[model samples]
Target: MIILLIWVAVLIAVLVLYLRQIYSRFSRYGVKHFKPVPLLGNMTRILLRINHFADDIFSLYRSFPEEKFVGRFEFLNEIVLLRDIELVKRVCVKDFEYFLDHRSVFSTSDSFFSRNLFSLKGQEWKDMRSTLSPAFTSSKMRLMVPFMVEVGDQMMSSLQKKIKESKSGYIDIDCKDLTTRYANDVIASCAFGLKVDSHNDVDNEFYAMGKLSSTFNFRQVLIFFIISNAPKVAQFLKLDFLSETSKKFFRKLVLETMENRELKNIIRPDMIHLLMEAKKGKLTHEDIKPNDGAAGFATVEESAVGQKEINRVWTEDDLIAQAVLFFIAGFETVSSAMSFLLYELALSPDVQEKLAQEIKETDVKNGGKFDFNSIQNMPYLDMVVSELLRLWPPGIGLDRICTKDYNLGRPNDKAEKDFIIRKGTGVMIPAIAFHRDPEFYPNPDKFDPERFSEENKHNIPMFAYMPFGIGPRNCIGSRFALCEMKVMAYQILLRLQVSPCEKTTIPAKLDRETFNIRLQGGHWLRFRARD
Candidate 1:
C-alpha cells in the first residue's frame, strides 16, 4: 500500500511539472497572455460555462490593446490570437501558403465528415476547391435564383397559412425556427436536389436529419471539444463529429441521388448537377469572369487558387463528401445568419421599412419580377446585410495551423524581437474582436447599416470585416449563402413586417452555454402583413 501511494504521488508530481512546462511556453518567449490553468488553460472558465468562445477570446484580445498578437491556450494547445490587420493580411493572403490548412476539427475515421472540403489538407484542398468553384459562380447563381424563389414562395405560403388561421392577422414567429426552416428548404432544393417545405412539413426526415447533424447540443459540444483538442485519440476511438444516423442518411441520400441522376440522365441546374458535371471534367476555369456578380459586399472574392484547375479523377466518396459538406455549411451557417438578420430587422424598424420600400420599388421597376440581378443591385439591402454580419458574424473566429516555421514578427513595437510561430502551431484570428473594435467601427455596438455605404465602405480598413471568413480558403459557399438569405429576406419583407413580441428580449443577449450564436431567451418576434 505504501509503494502504491508513492507511485501515485510520483505520477501526480510528473503531471504537475509537465503541465507547468507546457503552460510556460508563452512566458519563455515573452509573449503576452493571461496565466493558463493546468489542463483547461484559458478555456477553464469557458468549459465551466462562465463564458463562451467569442466573448471570452475577445476579452483576452481586448486585454492587450497595444499588442499586435496575444497568446491563447485552447486546452493544452497554444494558439496565437492575431490582433494586427497587417498580420491578418499576411496570414490570410500574402503568405497564405505557409498556413494552408485550418486546424483539424474532426477525426479522420469519419470519412464523409473528415474528407469534406473544409477538412481536406494542402493539395487535396486546392483541387477540390477549384473543382467546386464553378458551381458557385455568378452565372450559376443566376440559374439557382428560381430554385431559391420557389423555396421562398413555399415559406411564404406556410407563414400566410399560419397568419390566416390566427385571430390576429400577425403571428408570433420563432425567428430561429422560421429562418432555419427556410434555410433548410433552400439548401434542400439547391444543394441536395430535393424539394422540402420545412415550414409546413416541420417533422421532415431531411430537416430532422440535418438538425441532428449540425446542431451543437450539450453532448455534441463535449464530443467536439475532445475531437478538436485531441484528434488522434478521437480517431482511434472513432468519435466522429456526425451522429451515426446522420452519416447513414446523408451518405445514402447523396450516393443514391447521384446514381439516379446519372442512370436517368436527368439534368438539373442545381449544385448536384454542377458537381456531376465536375465529375465528368466538364467544368473549367472560364466559368469565372473577372466580376462574378457577387451577391453583396460581404461575399468572399474568388481568388487565383480557386481559379486554377487541377486535373484529378473524383471518387464516389469524394463526391458524397462534397455534397455533405455543402449541405452542413449551407444549412447551419446560412440559417444562423438568416435568424440574426431577422432579429436585427425586428429591432430596427427604420431599417426594415427602408428595406421593404426598396423591395417594393425594385419589384415595380422590374415590373413585379425581381430576379437575381435586381436583388443583388439593391444597395440598401446589401448595406443592411453587411452591417448585420459585422455585428453578428456566424463564425465567431477563424483558425489556421502553420504548415512551416514562419517569423510572426513582434507582438508589438514594445516587444524587443520577432516571435516565431513554429510548424503545427495554431493561430486564431478573432473576427468578432476586429469587427466590434471601436477603432475600426465607431460605436461598434450600434446597428448602423450606413457603415457599408458605397462612399463610406472604402474608408473601413481591409481585413477588419470577415463575416464569411478571410483569404482564399474563406467560406466557399458565401455566394450561395448570401443569395439564399437575401432572396428569403426579400420575400418575407415584401409580405410581412416583423416587430418585437412579448417574448422578445429588448436587447439581445448571448446564450452562455453554446459556441454558436443564439439569444438567451430565444429569438421570438411577431410577423404581420405590411400596411
Candidate 2:
C-alpha cells in the first residue's frame, strides 16, 4: 500500500511538470494570455457556461488592446488570437499559401458535410472552391433574383394575412421565424428546384430538415467544442459532425433531384444545375475564374494532382456535399441577417422610416416595379445592410491552421523580435471584436448606416469591415445572400412598417446558448400595413 501511494505521488508530480512545461510556450513567444488551468485551460468559463463562447473570446480580445496577438489555450492546444489588422491581412491574403486550410473539425472521408468548401482542407478545398466559384457570380445571382422575388412576395402575403387576423392593425410577428421561412423558400427554389411554401406550411419537410441539419443544440455544441479543440482526439474516436438522420435526408434528396433532372432533361438556372454541369465535365476555366474583387488575382499553386486530373470526374457524393453546404450555409446565415436587420429597424424608427422612404422613391423611379437592377441601385439600402452585417456578422471569429512554419515579425520593429508559429498552430481572427471596437467604429454600439456611406466608408480602414471575411476563402454565396436580404427587406418595407412591439426585447439580449449571434426569445416586432 505504501509503494502504491509513492508511485501515485510520482505520477501526479510528472503531470504537474508536464503541464507547466506546456503552459510556458506562450510566455517564451512574448504572447499575452490568460493563465491556464489543467485540462480546461482558458476555456473553463465557456465550458462551465459561466460566459458564452463569443463573450469570452470578445473579452479576451479586448483585454490586450496593445498586443499584436494574444495567446490562449483552447483545451490543451494553444491558439493565437490575431489583434493586428496588418497581420490579419497577411494571414488571410498575402501569406495565404502558408494557411491554405481551415481548421477542420471532421475529415472529408468521415462525413459528407466535412467534404463541403468550409471544412475541406488543402488542395481538395482549392479545387472544389475554384470549380464552384462561377455558380455564385453576379450573372448567376441576377438569374436567382426572380426565384427570390417569388419567395419575397409569398412572405409579404403571409405578413398581410397575419395583420388581417390580428384584432389590432399591428400584428406581433417573430421576425426570425418569418425570415427563416422566406430563406427556406428561396433556398428551396434556387437550390432544389422546388417551390416550397414554408410560410404557409410551417412544418414542411424541407424547412424542418433544414432546421434539424443546422441547429447547434446542446449535444452538437459539446461535440463541436470537443472536435474544434481536440481534432486529433475526435478523429481517433471517429466522431462525425453531421447527424446520421441529416446525412441520410440530404443525401437522398440530392440523389433524387439529380436523377429526376437527368431523366426529365429539365434545365433549371440554379445551383444544382450548375453542379450538374460540373458533373458532366461541361464546366470550363472561364466558368470558375475568380471575378469578385474580394478574391485576389494571385494564382493558386497547382495541386499534387494536376487540374485536368482533378476536374475529370465530380461524383454523386461530391454533388451531395455541395448541395448540403448550400442548404446549411444559406438558410441560417441569410435568415439571421434578415431577422437582425428587421429587428434593428424596428428598434430604430427613424432609420426604418428613412429606409422605407428610399425604397418607395426607388420603386417610383422604376415605375413601381422593384426589379434586380432597381434593388442594386438603392444606395441607402446597401449602406443599411452593410452596417447591419458589420454589427452582427454571422461568424463571431475566423480560424485558420498553419500549414507551414511562419515567422511573425513586422518589418522595422526591433522591440518585438520574430515569433515562430509552428506548423499546425490555430490562428484566430476575432471578427466580432474588430467590428465592435471603438477604435475602428466610433460609438460602436450605435446603429449608424452612414458609417458605410461612400463618403464615410473610406475613413474606415481596410480589413476593419469584413462581414463576409477576406481572401479566396471568404463566403462564396455573399452575392446571393445580399440579393436575398435586399429582396426580402425591400418587399417587406415597401408594404409594411416594422415597429417595436410589447414582446420585443429592448436591448436585444443574445441567446447565450446558441453558437451564432442569435437573439433571445426570437426577434419580435409588430408589422403595420401601409395604407
TM-score of each: 0.97, 0.94
lDDT (tens digit, per residue) of candidate 1 on 1-531: 999999999999999999999888777777899988778888787778777677797789899899989998878988899999999999999999999998888787446877888989999999999998888888888888889999999989988888988998889978888888888888888887899988878899999988887887656777787887888888888887677788888879887888999899988898788888888988877868764546888878788989997778888788888888888788788888888899899999999999999999888888867678976779999999889899999888888999999999888787778888989889999888899999999999999999999889997887998998888999888778888888988999999899999999778878777767888788899988888
Q: Which 10-residue window of candidate 1 scores lowest in summed lDDT?
A: 285-294
How does model 1 fare in lDDT? 0.86
lDDT of 2 by residue, 60-158 (tens): 998887788888898778788888899999998899998888886774385886778888888788778767766766667778888999888888888
- Against the true structure, candidate 2 reaches a TM-score of 0.94
Each model's RMSD to truth, in Å?
A: 1.4, 3.4
Top candidate when judged by lDDT against the true structure: 1
lDDT for model 2, please.
Answer: 0.81
Clashes of 2: 0
